[model samples]
Target chain A: MLEYIVLGMVNYEDMTGYDIKKYIESGISVFYKASFGSLYPILKKLANKGLVAMYESNHGDRKKNYYHITDEGRKAFEIWLETPIMIDDGNGTQLVKIYFYDLLQEDKRRELLIRYRENNVTYLKGLYELEEQYVNTRNKDCYYYKLSVLYYGIRIIKETIKWCDDIIERKDLSEI
Target chain B: MLEYIVLGMVNYEDMTGYDIKKYIESGISVFYKASFGSLYPILKKLANKGLVAMYESNHGDRKKNYYHITDEGRKAFEIWLETPIMIDDGNGTQLVKIYFYDLLQEDKRRELLIRYRENNVTYLKGLYELEEQYVNTRNKDCYYYKLSVLYYGIRIIKETIKWCDDIIERKDLSEI
Candidate 1:
């Protein structure tokens, strides 16, 4: 959550609750998920904890709530930055989804495959473009991570596409 | 969750629940996560639904439950394979962590910095090994995706390290 918050800060300087959700979803792979229900509350908590400072502003007729990292927030972020994250054992969503894939009818599986392929293709193309964008604009440190993410995105899509082919070949689900 | 299940199927052809969990965490940079709290119930539900069928064995005086994908489960997985996933949006822990870095005391910030650096470096090294492993393996499609993840892993580490350096150069947080 903090990494994303800082990403918002890095990307937009200062933004409101709405901005964060928009930014993450637009390019943040299907694997990465967040909800506003938790986001707003988390923001409030961040402010309360003094990790983030909040403000209110009006744009046109709309009132907007804003948050920014405090110096204290930065310090805290730095500390978090230094810490190592352990890959604690937990549920794997991809596996669960696949496990139950057979529960869906053949047609449903086909629909899913088509949709998944389309999604991956679109995402991969966009990522390729983004790589160009980063290069064309000379985006530096702040932007390099985007490249990393994009690379992963494309790779996953390619692999998924291939996996779909393999499964189809092995099982011949369409014929069945 | 489905991905984890598939992982279980693919890794060693068949696995007990414990073996499944260990296989994923140790081998794949898997997207699956499961908890004992949820696993038993879900497993039973899957079995009930015919997505998975099970067998039991006694090992070292302990009862073991083993599951394998059924034709129905395979079909279900296939259908799911093609479906487009809805990627939920939400908080990024790293971003959130960065946002609040300023809240900590100087020593705390330094501590975070140290921890973050250690983590990134460790992960970065692991990524390098993965890349090499990918190079040596026949699963290029999967390895491609792994490489992509590693790419981001590297960029994120660089950013974190750079931030730590920036703090050291720009401020004297020691007295704070």
Candidate 2:
């Protein structure tokens, strides 16, 4: 999966490992993230497999290696893109916590639920701001589908906020 | 995390590794799942740490080890329950593919979007069925908040389906 992501980014433009990390953090961190530990190793493997070509350039005191996708990499990526997307049930930790929340006392459960709700509010606000930025700086060549992904993020976050509100509301009702 | 889940199930009642896996698959697999490989090891570690007590029971030429959470385990689970839940952005692979979708031909892109949309419809149907089952069961001790997690799953899948439709519609407009 990381290999495909690396190939996807390299397919966009030539990038050093650091550049790839930066790109993921800025644009796609909401849905995915990778640490340098996993990033560099995958990059090395991809380069060795001839899927990506690494070239080094010297810039004064530093040497940087940039990766460019090969013809084979593009073909592989195209095949991967055709594979159907699986519906992710999402990361399960939070849901598991909620299921077992009866273990906590009333005050503790309310505190956790409130904090979770607040976090979603903050996250949704950030997604909205990002969408606004994309709209304001719209590029004619920018594929509409690209922006649609951001909307996907925004919509889910909005639903999450609503879920949070409902949970908090129910907690209040139970008290009365 | 697996350990916490193991403790969570044991907190409910004494269960062997096989039982835990079965319970997760039937009840919470929508949000969480575990393989016996990881489950047994984590269970063993928990026993070693005195967080859970392992008991052996004989059942007609078979031996089963059941785990029971200790007092300390309950205390730990209580604290863990209070920990705030993080909002999952979901599996990033789908979003990542969408972001780079311009690399594909127009027809291929539409095909992928349509397939993705259909997959969400299937997922949404399953969630609705699960919700109905929960409502019908109507166990007095069944916590409302636990069912809210299923709602969260249903809501996100619905939003994802809508996003897929919007992208498909936008693609058609672009063709015009």
Candidate 3:
């Protein structure tokens, strides 16, 4: 819900669901994301709320639905923007996964820990590319803000990888 | 939803919703959140799923509804925990707020900007507390990851506050 609204309001002048999803995955949304399941549902809901309107374009075999923000939508977005919204589910799964890392057999837990590190590295690679885009664009101010988020991702991932390594090698989870 | 699930899984030993809420607020979930709304709904759903069972108690005008994780719920939470989840929400509300700063009347925008800074400061305050907690609880290996988030929030808020201050002093929006 937020990812599209943010995309519609920020990155591109306008976007379709596919475009938004692609943009999000392109490392632009290291902070925000909308899955296809969530994205399709939200687009319909936003249009119904009269904050967004969609137009269909014929692309031969593919008909494209492009969503544009309405005055009402922009206003609504701004209102939401102004409001103090608490982000829930901030890092629930990772913590839970760690909290229950003991649930797995020791070796399986060791393997999962290694895999998590690999995942972090993969994500950091995407962030690195996004950082280049922001820098090349020379929107230094905005780019820096994006970089700030990227840096945060890097730091956390580094920390996770380190923690997991220490856990796997450190003799015991109960001690640390 | 997650809060209740986590709480119920823990509470399989026995606990109250109040205890669950307090535990979450106590910085145990510095990364994620589970509010009463999400918690109550999840409790009902998990119960319906036969993953949890709830019993109500009337204690001095206070009704403490407690939840227990059934074996099914434990299995479900374990499965849910292992699901490969993603974390992101990269649409820039901060930039959205900055760009539209002009859309707001001069006085309103400045107030809004100040309010944003103030809010960021409050958020930074929380992060700082988490940083302290992480430092005390964990070794240096985890410091960078945890401290990085703290620094990210702190720096971004600092940058934003500085940006707003510069704009206010120079009356930059007059050009707009």
Considering every candidate listed, which one attains the maximal DockQ?
2
lDDT of 2 by residue, B105-175 (tens): 67877777777677678756766776676677766244575566666676677777777777776743222
Task: Please say which candidate is ahead in TM-score: 2 or 3.
Answer: 2
Clashes of 3: 5
Best by TM-score: 2
What candidate 1 gets wrong by more than 4 Å, as runs, is A2-12, A22-35, A84-176, B3-14, B25-38, B59-62, B68-71, B82-176
- How well is each residue in B1-176 modelled by candidate 3, as lDDT tens digits? 35334543353355566676665443223234567887667667767888778888788898888778878777665454333222123322223223223223556655655665566566557546655665677665532333333333344445545554656553332122
Q: What's model 3's overall lDDT?
A: 0.51
Q: Model 1, range A69-115, lDDT digits (tens) per residue?
A: 87777676544433332222221123213322433456655665566
Per-residue lDDT of model 3, residues A1-176, tens digit only: 45335434432356788887774443223334567998888888888888788899877988898888888877675444333222233442223224223324566656665666676576557656755654676555423322343444444545555555766674332233
**Local error of candidate 1 at residue B46 (angstroms):** 1.2
TM-score of each: 0.41, 0.52, 0.38
> Candidate 3: fnat, from 0 to 1?
0.15
Clashing pairs in 3: A31-B88, A31-B89, A31-B90, A32-B89, A32-B90
Candidate models: Cα lDDT each? 0.49, 0.67, 0.51
Instruction: Give the per-residue lDDT digits (tens) of candidate 1, residues B1-176.
Output: 44435423532355676776554333232233455556667677877887777898888899888887777776665444333222222212222233223334566556655665566576557656655654676454432323333343345445545545655343322221
True contacts kept of 2: 0.47
